[model samples]
Target chain A: MRAPGGVGRRWAPVLAVLAVLQCFTLLLLGLGQSAHAGDRPRGCGQPLPVAGSAGFANAQAARRTNVNTYGAAAIVEQATASQAYSGDLASRFRSGEGHFRLTFNDTFGAARLLTLCDDRDPGDQQTVMGVDDRDRWLKKDRLYEQPLDLYATNVYVSGGAQAIGGFYSASVTQSVLGYRGAMVAGQVINLYPAFFAPAVGNWQRGDGVASYAVDWVAGGYLDLGAVAARVGTAGANGLFVTVDERAIGLFGTLSRGVGEAQADPLAYLRAGLQGFSLRRFGAPRLSEAIGQSSLFFRDMPVGVDPSGDAELSRLRTLHLDQRAIAQQVEAALSYRVGQQSGLYDVHLGWHTPGFYGERSDLKGSVEAEDEGFGIRVGMIDVAPRYSLGVQGGRYFSARAQLRGEAITGMILFNDPEQLALFPFATNALSLRLVVDLAAGG
Target chain B: MSRSPHRPQRPARPGRLSSRSLSWLTLAAGLGCTQEVAPDRFCQEAATAIAGRTEACTGDLDLADARYAAFYEAYTCVDVPVESMGEDTASPIAPQDRLHCAFAIRNLPCSLVEAYGDDIEQYMTASPICDTLVQPKGGAR
Candidate 1:
């Protein structure tokens, strides 16, 4: 039976093909021919405007975030080690029999699954890593700074933006595994170090005495430590992630007590949380962009022919990467609500110790009691999309971000999966003046 | 196993034991020998005819395109030879392969390429796979 107009025409062929293929096995797409086999893909998104202090040194090479992030650390101990190579690396990479290729649709995993049916909140790519950082390091490459040395001169470029924001705005963006939850949640409340705050002097509605510096409203929070660890270890070809074993805690408390501490019923509640705060070694630059070429060592087995001419089957190349790590934790707190004179966003979070994603870290945030109450006017956490693609949770970013949009900024822990759609993660504290329109409102 | 003296096994004696082993084997070998004597016998001719035609059509002498070759080596593939009444395939080149080959040899002298440059190109596209034998060869287009 045919339908009316163009609809029927389009579907008729498809229906016929499906019906024929279903009945006759010979009409398969591949006809049983195996797919090409070689290497798994390396994935990295756009630059995240999350790290205000970080230079976009590697934004051009998003995949290389891990490599450059580790810098001299990757060779801290490997220096002076005897170098040895047996054969051409590529030549040794013979395709295994029966190996096949597999392709993943955009936004595949938990996040996509959750948002698959939802019309709003499309996921997208964010957080770029590339620039001056080449994926190489001597046994001891010097740090990057003024009075450049032999290591810094040949190691990194002077271009690229810094990472500042995170994932929470991954709107319809797809990954190999359908936006699996990498870093989906966090909570932060601080006025300073504000990478994405509105311009200070553009006060359209307030006086200097009681000014509104910034306002944020986030609803999803994914685990940054888990995400940093997972995507960081994607391949030995990029950066390396190391979790500290020390039982360090991230303790933060924000309290405003008045003249009489005991009699002040208006004493702001003090919230403190302690644990390990994770850290990550941003990967090295990936992909050839701008004016750049990746020099790779070709390894092909030497083949002999009857005519004395050598034949090389195929050429294979490997891009090596080196990295390093450090210990640090990021924590923030404020009054849950605005006081008579300022803003307050009180919160409790559990974090593990050190650099990027920590191995052991459990963090959660308790939003202000009246955040979603119908009576409240500034509450916007309705039907939020989490990094896990879960509904009704605050979106959070869990990695150092390098947002490329105007008003650029960096976020320490933006969920790649969630921010794959939303630009802000780590906490539901949605802020104003974000380049991503989705997060601001 | 013991055999009945009265009803001797069909393949046990009185026949070419070298040619036949058992009832089933005997039948298969019998057919084989029959074809050797009369090679054109339908069943005997079918297998070689089917195989030769496929190889000839493939044009490739080796595993150059292993991806496509795997299809032929597949367990489920079927084979059928061109019947005497079947269209003459002695042309060596399939109609389509001919056009592609012709275009591939464009500009070469005394070849289909020089004779019908535009026409060959229109039919075979600008380039043809290196193996086709269209003319003026030298791995034309």
Candidate 2:
């Protein structure tokens, strides 16, 4: 007789490939539609929407220059026009134009109002304010203030199921970046599945029963001595463990333009519903279950008090009982300088407490890299962890390249109590070899 | 600049080091070669050093009048059982070493403190004299 579940096992890889192909086809279709729609001009009297308060701040900064030439009357007229434009934009955003319209409806509107009155463009004020003609000044002013106006939309789908030896993993991501204004905003959907099987002796029978069932069936035989030997061999050869973990995450990002003069530096905000899962399976031990669950799934309610329940409070402190989906937000200000051969960038940011379950630290990162070699260093404050990553690459052909990367972290300062519960070892290192098949290798 | 007991003296002819050497030295220091000190003494010394540095740096009359009350309150030593400080049974901070680290931070030079500025807490833990506060069980250090 055929082995049990053989048909399903044989079809798994084919099904996975089909799914990936379907996703890519949909992504390509979306891209074509978005590209066609992007070029269409806004309705008459509708000022193009800008990203968040940074856009308004740029407008205000430009207005200070207008005061000298156009005078108070022009400012008053502009204000009236701006209010009407904002109201219309807000209504359209609520009506849902893009994928993020439903997700970030309230957030986008709220963020647009977060105008920092003190934010000023530290560029050549004279040139910004200098406008010779009063007749076409408003149109010129708008053009001058905006750093980026090229509206382009793109959708990318990458990664699929892969099985190498005993290791099995599948990850797929669809990212959509579109132009709403001068800044680019988008949403990403990621599906990740974790599955692994050891190459050791068969742990399961043809009928899907564990091998231990045979011992149990034979007159309740208990082999304690043999159990230890089996475990030792399993550990040495890689344990007979299967983790059925799957997570789906949604992410949204909003950014401000770097300004006409400041082309390299950009300030952005990002928020995500990072892996909100309701059910999980296949973890045998409590620690393993907790660790796996914590990695991709977070289900704790945000901005609520759990003080009444002592157990809940304890779990939150240990980051254990997370079963309600919550939002994690990050804001970063970054600057980058690029050359023909290489580029350097630095960023400073803050993450909400318990952000993505663990990375709640105020962080700063610096990366300086070229085509052949690169290095990145990131420092975070909570555990005071310092992540160092080094990458080296070699080009095989015009369309093929190979790269190797090594990443490690050092916990300079840590709370011993916290470390005991969530073991983040400083000695852990990750090595990866990536092969790139692209046009520009 | 006038020197104090809390501040380490710089050599009259300070040896010049290349940028690469300086980077290596900084990395080595960050790796942490620490010395043990009594907690109470460390607290006292740290508080004194901070108070003295604040008085020297501040030009604000109101802050001077307050005599940096906040700094003193934060750095002041409190009596607590060593076990209460950490929950890790495998490796915990030795009470004496923790105290010593505290003292060393309190005695850091004004220049060094100013250089670190907002990142003083991070520097303190990563500092050579304070890094070994957390030691394996039975105070192996």
Candidate 3:
């Protein structure tokens, strides 16, 4: 049955009341220029691993039997994307990389290197903005170096069903400029419970990650990890020092077989869930430094407190707990088969706020607008993704495999009115190819 | 019938190389061991230096510059809509909400474009002065 068309009519009064309350809270919070939260980059647009559950098992087995061993081919992958975005800059990206692993002393392991370079141009971004002259914006024939992954991993301990490891990886990305208006004269009115959508820009980041995992005999596993990152933007102030901010977070994942672990461990009926929460500290100092950077051309415009009074100082030292940044949850189902096996698995998963968040400033424009916001926004709405894959190879003869995946129901927020709205299928579609090269060949 | 295996006989040889030959051998071994460890380190240093290079604007900010003047004319005393500002990507306001510009500049300074030369494209896209002003395809409004 269709719902009434006048739903907004009833909510109009409630929203009016909220608007009043929002004004009052804006005074108490003394909000000013806010920064983007969350340690994970949004919308890298890389393809998920093929045949979700099965791929996990295959990777785990590879880690145990063939990974990090001296003189072994270990693992190699070649990937490309139709389009990828870092902050505001978007580009067509391609990557070719491999892992040269060395295993020693039985359980101790090390992946000598994990490296990839992401290349994208601001030209497309310029075009989307309507600039026809490439030379006007691009001073030289050059490409921006976007780091995909560049780090090494060490497995300090390993055994039959569990392992622990830590990694030190450093990479850079862009964070775009986000503009807001002021509520009071000469003061930027930033309110608590501030709404944010991802924009295209650069945010350079480097961090250390430590992870632990355990696998059960029933074709299931649990994984946990922590991240401490130094994230910042370019120093526009000419001093050439990065305006740095610190963030820390905890993340975990769990997967179990829905039916049963097949006689062949490679084949399984399984499902998995994953989530993360990240908090940024020292915001007050970072924002001030950024304002001084060449990026802003000036200090953070004056800020107002939650009590509706001018309080420029509040912007610098906001509490860590007060800033509950981003929390993400994801679930996926995947199936795989041995050349000899058949129909071994199935997966279904969902993530909230789906894939893309709305760019609130681009409210009316279609390119960045999300008409689904009014319905339901943020991580509560699961953007569903799925994959199916197959594998064949022996240790020494080398292994080769291929798979395909589809992600549906993701809400790309661009419009202000679409808040809390459910995403309908639109231009959101992607296809991916994965190749694994193993040892022996 | 059995056939005998062929074996070549050699005359007696010297027990050691001549002095001149030995010297040459030692030189060759020394050259082989020279791995050029420092060159690898130097390459890394050079690459990082280049990566860190950025362009800077020359000359002083001229208030009369058209771009700078335009910024003042449009944004000064105007309520600009701020959906998400700064690094905090959290609870944002709805569209149609407009905030006033605190800085009283007449135009967006050309220095901004020059100072952030690498990201000029982003500025062009977002800046009112350089915006293409194309409408959204669907009736999103």
Candidate 4:
């Protein structure tokens, strides 16, 4: 199905868009420059945990688990192609030297960090994250640290079932030239692009079944809590703090992801039918100040109003309702005794939920076992929600694949895109493979 | 230019064919083939094969693979194509092909080789790839 007038050559102008963007970030990183006295922003905090080391201990781990369960990973569901990118950089391991995540509890207290935004853009981001390099291997070299005080939210650029590279947003990756953040450990995120079709996921609450969050003012106020997991021994624990943009709203979002155990399938399934919600709030001034420290992933704010203007109005950067907020989630469950595939994960979600006055939702998707992969289908019975999705990609090996659709409909209520020339659409496809770097002895 | 004190001295030239074999190589690798194969064996095997047979074969598409992440590793490697005209004159690469250069220059200045990638036809061209490119710091000295 071709759109109107000759669209083939129209793609001519698309060649350098990604490269130009890459360059823009490069220029921001200033790869060739040296450290300047006042060049980099100062927002780095202490390092986080990596592969071998337990990241969040008891209290921290538990707190993070709740956030994850309550839907933090879901924020990374949908992403766009314009910014869908992921990779990593590493310093060879020394006996004592290692890598880490630079996370700051405060904007100015510590060093630099990754600043990701879950903007109000209707649909345009594929991956808005900076992940640890894929090169880092356990006992070899991987990410040693994460950015401090970063705001990461997943958005659906194109809805898909597989979460290969869905979450999209930019983050400060490196420092200006020679100036490294004062924090000992460096920071980097592997911003890979996910490819898959979009549809309602597994679990879904009945229309208005889940209670919506309470309302709050758009100011310096933020909701935070600690998540702790058992670090090495019972003696210590790892900590992860969840930061949400708004205090309330009930909207669902979508993404294409795969995992040993999809983060939380039920959460995603529920969101697919009921989109998530967002109340507008401006990025913290400190968020920007912290970002200014590094050249990599350094993006200047393009503040504007919904009326197609750059005038900053309303308390929060812009008056955001239901349209602007979105999500991306990766959920999987992995136990040994794997039969067909070494690891099998029932990817239950990655959807945009309804947040504007709609009740929480109940949604579910089923992957029909067919060819090497399966036909992915899903539905939602949310009170009021509407979205579009199409995904096609490989979940595990290049041979074992998944290529088909399951759902595209208005789940519960009103969709804002009634009059737009084309309704919102999300599409994806990915072929994955595995390679052995080190020989098994 | 002054050499850095930390940089290792270049190794004396070894057998031209000193390279590793791709035996059932899966894709998850991140490093280019780092197996320490003796070049003599590789050259001998090639010499034994007929010239026609050699042309019919294309080298492995996977570079620096890790078993666990072969799929991801392949996705990460970029393929930048270029043409070598006769007498050292090279043609300007297509804009799409030049993306590797842009990527290497952008956000990843240090990984020019990884970002720019190997020419698709170079392996078949039978040029001394090992002799031309320097070994990355991780390889055996």
TM-score of each: 0.14, 0.19, 0.15, 0.19
**Candidate 4's TM-score:** 0.19
Shift of residue A280 alpha carbon in model 2, Å: 26
Binned by DockQ into CAPRI classes (incorrect, acceptable, medium, high), candidate 1 is incorrect
Candidate 2: stretches off by over 4 Å: A1-165, A168-441, B1-24, B27-29, B36-141
How far residue A139's Cα lies from its native spot in candidate 4, in Å, is 22
Worst lDDT run of 10 residues, candidate 4 chain B, spans: B26-35
* Each candidate's DockQ: 0.00, 0.01, 0.01, 0.01
lDDT of each: 0.19, 0.22, 0.18, 0.18
What lDDT tens digits, residue by residue, belong to model 3 across residues B44-95? 2111111111111222212113232333233212122222222343524311
Model 1, A347-366: lDDT tens per residue? Answer: 12222221122222222111
Q: Against the native chain B, what TM-score does each candidate's chain B reach?
A: 0.19, 0.31, 0.19, 0.15
Backbone clash pairs for candidate 2 read: A299-A323, A299-A324, A300-A324, B39-B99, B46-B106
Please give the distance, in angstroms, between residue A185's alpha carbon in candidate 1 and its true position after superposition.
Answer: 32
Model 2: residue A47 alpha-carbon error in angstroms:
70
Winner by DockQ between candidate 2 and candidate 1: 2
* Candidate with best lDDT: 2
Please give the lDDT score for candidate 2. 0.22
Locate the minimum summed-lDDT window of 10 residues in model 1 chain A: A145-154
State the lDDT at B4 in candidate 3.
15
> Could you tell me which 10 consecutive residues in candidate 2 chain A have the lowest summed lDDT?
A209-218
Please rank every candidate by lDDT, starting with the best. 2, 1, 4, 3
